[model samples]
Target: MNRLLCLLIGLLCISCTSVAQKEKYKKEKVYTVSKTNAEWKEILTSEQYYILRQAGTERPYSSPLNKIYKSGTFHCAACDSPLYESKYKFDSGTGWPSFDRAVEDAVDKDVDYKLGYARSELLCATCGGHLGHVFNDGPRETTGMRHCINGDALVFKHKESKNE
Candidate 1:
């Protein structure tokens, strides 16, 4: 009986330690240093509001860019900076929009070692907003690159853009 009780105590200690470690690993620090409430709201749409400002992702297949393949540049919703041009885009089976690369001075790539793996994270240079992840697994004829971006983070401007 005493042995059974000791074993139970040991198990409980181990479980508590594991739980604490998991929490430490998954902790996300939110910064309140940048934009104010009205600034963020004024710069973002409802969907962009949830994703870029709140770190949320849109449901797959819902982005109009999934069907968009025209001559235009995709801009950051927050800053109106050119991100991806229509020329580098391709249909990557991962579902979220894919591009071969980003426009110059548009994306800021940081080495992300999240989830115990090495990856490059894409962000808006101007606002430090999360865009998405980039991968090397792409088509043969293509740049062998995949810039899997979040739809809510982008606002597509058609080629010969009338909105300019």
Candidate 2:
């Protein structure tokens, strides 16, 4: 039927548009810790490679860092650059480890339209590793922003006690 044919055509157009929008931000950049693809593969695990290099996201509420509440710092897994402080972290209940802010000059944000909408995409300023997204919802008493990050992209270091 002509009705069925027209409906199919309309669906196809929508699919094509969505695909095009997703790839709009796929261009590569020169990172501070630039390495050959093979070199990066050797240095990082398979999951880290997928998220940091390919801009993939980890499963929500799946990061051990989400439950971490110790006094310490979180560094980029790729380059070991300090990115966040323990004081800024909070439970946003959005799965990932959410922070109210990053350390000064530690992260660089860019407009990401991968999901067909604009979002603040956070990256490691030192290595350009994709951390996650930042949003406006956060502690009103503090920064009023949430830096939702992937635990796979970070390595947490607990502060040493003076008594020890």
Candidate 3:
């Protein structure tokens, strides 16, 4: 009986401490770091700069993926984060680029209700840069998901190409 009382008291104290710690460590959104002009010029192309930094979208049907049928990796232009793979690339006929999945750990999801519909917005995990939105209404047999990405957010890395 003595041991049982001591264990119960110890557990209660631990629980109280945990609750206090949780209350003290409140969560807050940390915005992504802004890049300087020189840093942006060094890392990104002119098109990449307009989209990733200025939140500009590329012209529809202008993406190379509109006709891309090759094998390669797609990476974020701003942060050099590997995003999508060639295997998951599919033609969604959406003008903008599309993917079935992002490279593992490449994307971070958050709530976005931009069009008045609840959506899962994905960002480049490395830089907290916005990538695109994910929807559950995609084709079956897969994840039933579509990662509708902005063409401006990514730069293609073709397997045969020597460009880094």
Using lDDT as the measure, the top candidate is 2
Model 3 ranges off by over 4 Å? 1-38, 41-47, 161-164
Q: Candidate 2 regions off by >4 Å?
A: 1-29
Best by TM-score: 2
In model 2, how large is the Cα lDDT of residue 132? 94
Better of 1 and 3 by TM-score: 1
Q: Which residue pairs of candidate 1 clash? A: 71-159, 72-159
lDDT of 1 by residue, 39-151 (tens): 88886788887777665668888888877888888888877788899888898877798999888877777766555886788888777677888888976686888999888
Q: What's the true lDDT of residue 153 in model 2?
A: 97
* lDDT value, residue 76 of candidate 1: 82
* lDDT of predicted model 3: 0.78
lDDT of 2 by residue, 39-79 (tens): 88999999898888788899998889999988899999999
Pairs that collide, model 3: none
Q: Across residues 1-164, which tens digit of lDDT does each residue of candidate 3 receive? A: 99999999999999999978976896744546456768876787787777765555678788776566578888887877789988887788778778888899888887765678777888888776677788876668787889988887887888875653
Write the number of the candidate with greater lDDT, choosing between 1 and 2.
2
Q: What lDDT would each prediction earn against the true structure? A: 0.81, 0.92, 0.78
Off by over 4 Å in 1: 1-34, 111-118, 161-164
Ranking by lDDT: 2, 1, 3
Better of 2 and 3 by TM-score: 2
